[model samples]
Target: MTAPRASIGALSSAEFLPQRVSLLYRLSGNDVPAILLTSAIAAFALWGYISDKLLAAWLIWLVLASLVRFVLKRAYRLRQPGPEAAARWEGFFCLASAFVGTAWGVTVMLLYPEHGQFHEILLPFLIGSVAMGLPPALAPSPKSFACLIVPIFTPLIGLLFTQGGAFNTSAGILILVFSAVLLALYLSSNRALIETLRFGRENERLLEQVKEAKDRLDLALQAANILIWDWDARRTNVFLGGNWAIILRVGKETSALNLDELAQMVHPDDLPKVKQALDNCLNGGESEYVAEHRVKTLAGGWVWSLSRGRVVERDAGGRALRVTGVNVDIDDRKRAEVELLAAVQREKELSEMKSKFVSTASHEFRTPLATMLSSAELLEHYSESLSPAEKANLLQTIQGGAKRMSEMIDDVLTLGRAESGVLKLNLGPANLRELCSTVVSEFRIAQGKQHVITLDDRFDRPDVIMDERLLRHILNNLLSNAVKYSPPGSEVTFSVSRRNEQAAIEIQDRGIGIPLEDQPRMFESFHRASNVENRPGTGLGLAIVKKAVELHGGEISLTSAVGSGTRFTVMIPLRPVKQPAGVS
Candidate 1:
């Protein structure tokens, strides 16, 4: 029943006039044969009562009028005039019908017999029969029906009343009543026809609007990368629409999928979560289903999507019969969330490392400070009573404490520079064999009496472009660790060789090796092996050595066991030698 306001008004207005005209023309054709036959019968009955010429003339006029109406109907069919010419066609029809009605009126006045009782009754009855039939044929146009009916009935009724007799008066009254009823019937049928056409137009307009609205909705959903879905619980089938194939990375032919097929496309890890959400909603545990999961694409990859739905239709027993939902592409948002979490985790690790560094630095610095303080106190308070040898021993103790503190401070500064990415390599010519031998000889003079240290220089090209300071740091730390961790009389070996255009240095020691679990983080700042309990070291030696090696474009690796010995390998790429000004 709902229609546009413009269309509703036009239904009753001149907009429908063309359709009414067309209906009138078509219906009038059926009445043509009936009209001609009725006229012939009336003329035959009046033959003996009236003059042959008068009866023949009236019959000829009626036949001519009927023929004119037939011609008009034929013309209308041939032309099929549009709405613009509806008024002109309607005028022609009404005029032709009026001419026919006037011919019938002349029959009553000219052909009614004065002496013949049966003829008088016959003439009026024939005219009245024709009037009654007009309503249905011309219902679509009440004006045309009026034009035909009034001319025929007015004269017949008046003549009956003017003639003097009870029969004439009664006949006139009956004819008048019948005329009134026929007019009323015409009006009623006309109103019914208009109502039917109005409803038809409204239905058509409503259909057009519904189509437009559905098209707009489809466009909006496609632009937003959203797909609508409808599920029929009874059938166990899903209907997908609105860019579904594009968003899901599937073929357009794939518009319907069963629950099992849908589950197969979901990521294995996220299947349970998606299923649980749907079950909760279907079972009335929740009013809606919402879940984020990864869907497999045709290209053998996964993309994140957010699904939302609600049970839109239910049975009498409160069980879901149908559900409607949407799937949204959320791959970008999910990726961003993962990256944010990684950044947060990295920040947390850095904070923990900072805390550990402060605690270890405090503990390491306190020991040396205490040693220096006690040694200075002893030398100051017992200067008069102490012998020369005893005084010398206290001074040595003070110097050793200060030296240890200075070494620890230097290691802390060097590690800080390396971690901050401010450490740079100063490349120049240096001999790898000499550097190794020099470090070994220094360690022998220092602790060679306790532990045996040896250097095997196998590298043919020992003179290479390198950072001397960084190389010395690498040699000094490895030798120190080897000597310190090993028992007295244990042997340590340092070997230098060339491998694949790089210098390879290997240091081996028969020491109480690092624990397997702690070896992975051996180069981490302030991270000491768990087995090095009560060892007199700050745990920064290997950390500094790692940074120095990295600055020279090198890699360091180690192999160790808890009870067996450990070996460290450092590989540095040899820099190409620079030639003098003219050399290429």
Candidate 2:
């Protein structure tokens, strides 16, 4: 068996061997026509000089050799061998080449004339032409080229030298020199072909690897919900990729849009800032463009996105030519931040409310405590010397102060329950007219001639299902505030009416009304109007009333001016009672 052929450059890497073998087969297949033509011409040239039988046999042998090469080429195409079988195929090719070379070499010995000068010259010349034409076709495999040239030239040169004449000797020397030159040319051509094939295979592999890497990067970007974009500043167009369709709720056909088209999808409120940031980067005022803004989605909603980019390419004049960037979904993060800020503000406001409660409670308790103490001391020291009227007056004053303190304490506790979220509705049936009448009578008795409190019961359906306890709290505080804030003998109207399915309770008092600026926060815990100067009260009444109203699934609103008095309207939904429970 022939020794396994050495791989190209001694680099026996499996990848290189298969490629070299394939190129050898391709070059050989292309030379089939040239091989047949050359053999026919050489046979015809020598037909006249040799005996007919000898010439015919030589021609038949050459035809058989060429047929063997054609069969090998056909077999290689059908088998399609891998790298491991490369050497086997190459050896077969070299063997076929050696057979063809031997047929050519036999031409000189078979056709040479002993005394004919023309036949001698013609035989060598025909053999030399065939030998020189082979390097280009056989260059893919140096071993194959060697196999062909050695056999073809050896016979002709040996016959010339052994003739022992000056002409014969000179002819043999020149053939030897020509064979050496052809061998040199074959080696050089083979090296160049192998190098080119190796480089081409390397390039194909690199390109495949790059394509795979890009596919992986695209998948990663899609998973992360990141949108990549490229801006061609000169063309004023933007190309979007990487999850853009899913994130923007758009179609793939619209992936590329002009700058104006892209801007149209931006939120109008946020567009200016976005444009400024991009312009700054393009103008070289900033190294990178970054902005958090709202982008309008195809569904007609806005999404918050954090866009970041930089000028990737620029012209010689420093104008941006291309910008590359990515957009990350930040809608959820922005919402959380907004909620956090509101919570912080609420906490701060609660802190301030606590401080105000402490200060106001201290001052309110002092006045009532002083009144009770002074009244008690006067009765204790002057009971024996005082008349019954004087003694009764002192006792009454002490009782009044104690009642005021109890009311203040109740208001604070009610407000506390509302703030803690522990206040619940106790639903029951009650009479709207009677409840209003009761609250008005109580206020009338409490303030004798200071204010005239009137009740107008316009609600025909007075019986309704509600949280009566909360309703009482609502009415009592509103009426009490009306009577307390109004001037002496001012008319305070308490009107109860039914508006559709709701009970509307309006209490209008001609009093020192809330200031416009302070009205918005009037129901806040421990918050009082700025105009209520020297008013003897804790600021918890209206706050407690507001909370009670809310628990009853109702709303309370006020209309007020600085000197024209305030009107408070409480609208509570009239939920019907299905079962008998309790009455407030």
Candidate 3:
């Protein structure tokens, strides 16, 4: 199970020689304190004997104290060791171990056998016991164990070999052979420890690789509501990705879903085309499948989606077996396309309306201009040959034609302002009775006194706030329509009265009433009732009346029965809301 050198990332890898060496020192760090305490107690017990050698003993104590401080600091560091911390701990532990080894080595000379036989055997036994204990604690890093044990034992064994005597020479040879045996044991234990660490490190590296690949795949699919599908067409089964529940919003119910179950979610209208695309690919008519369709959501609503994929596996006959691809949400793009089409359609209708209005205006203006020009030419050529009465009649005809042309132009301009939401209101107190009286008088003169125009004011109060110009147009247009559409002697009644805070006016006429179907669109510009046969009119009158009544804060309505008569009612507030600043 040893980790391959090729797979180890760097010296940072846990199985690397230096990496294992550093871990070994960290594990042995706790033993340093125990060693310090034991050594201090032993030294103190021998203090009385070593008093003459006090300076040397004190130096050893100071070095041992420094080693204790360095050991504790490195021990704290290894509690939560990282790569960088391991390297730092190794340096500190190595320095402390070397110092401890050198101090014990010095004991061979400082506490030498020159003192007595009791010291000779006792000192070597103490150092030897400590050296032999190292192999287990430092097995993870054999180089570090050698650094301490070699220094401690080499001096004793070397001295024994150099001494000139049969007994001493035999003991030196024996010590040399023991040292060789210990080295062999250390090498064998170090090999086993390295192998274990290398196997564990390799397992950690493989697990990390798997997690990273999974994370990247999840990120790619999340960006646009993507769902993966693996279809086993031959078996009529489907297996979606692990992220299927998240993408489709199916909650935990995704377990039982299959290809046929998902197909049922397709909108009815789009299902046929969707099925055809799938058939083309599955039946070998096409190599790939692509379709945009509506799919039912968890909320029981349909959302647009585009699915794309190709056949990856097939039988010997090229019969499709597996198909895999993605379904991506595309609802926003579909909505934008629909709105743009509607906007284009509206612009086309407006263009056609403008052209129709132009044609109607030209024909309306020509009749009035022709009358005025011909009347003026008659008077100019026949004035000298005719009497004063004849000349005055021609002048009256010319004046009437000029008034007709002016009224047509005013109607066009008034309708334009009303439609644009910028009607000008000259609001003030007005005599409702007088306004009705004037409109009646003008209609009587224009119709040659044939139609009877009556005004009835029933208000307790006469004064009212209103836009005078717009109010006049409301009454005049209604009155003119009544007279123009009726027989020569039909009666047109205009009544003004105060009903609550409103000045209610009614214009009634015994004329051909508006048709049943045309009443709804009566106020639309350029619209004329279907029953108005051969009536010379611009059809702008009622449209302008509707706008004028609205501007004065009033409502206008009518009731008509064909072949009977029509009655129009208008209500204007006596004290309407105040206008915006500078509005007249």
lDDT of each: 0.83, 0.80, 0.73
lDDT of 2 at 479: 87
Compared with the true structure, the alpha-carbon lDDT of candidate 1 equals 0.83
Residue-wise C-alpha lDDT for candidate 3, range 414-449, written one tens digit per residue: 899899987888888787778788888877787886
Best by lDDT: 1
For model 2, what is the error of residue 50's alpha carbon versus the real structure, in angstroms, after optimal superposition?
Answer: 28
Alpha-carbon RMSD, each predicted model: 9.9, 7.9, 9.6
**Residues 1-584, model 2: lDDT tens digits:** 23455543455334456676787777665665676677568667766765665557655765676577668778888999987899888888888888778877776666655565564545464544655347777777767877877887898788888876877788788878877887787777776776787788889899989989988987898777788899886776789877776765654546688888888888999999999998998899999999999888777888899999999998889888899999998888889999999999989998988888888988998998998899899888877999999889888988988998898888877777888998888887898888888888888898998888888889988578888788888888888889778999999998989898899999999998989999998887788888789988777888888888888888999999988899999999988756547753
Q: Considering lDDT, where higher is better, how would the candidates rank from best to worst?
A: 1, 2, 3
Decoy 1 TM-score against native? 0.61
Best by TM-score: 2
Query: After TM-score superposition, what is the CA distance of residue 404 in candidate 2 from its true location, in Å?
Result: 1.8
Candidate 2 pairs with clashing backbones: none
lDDT of 3 at 416: 92
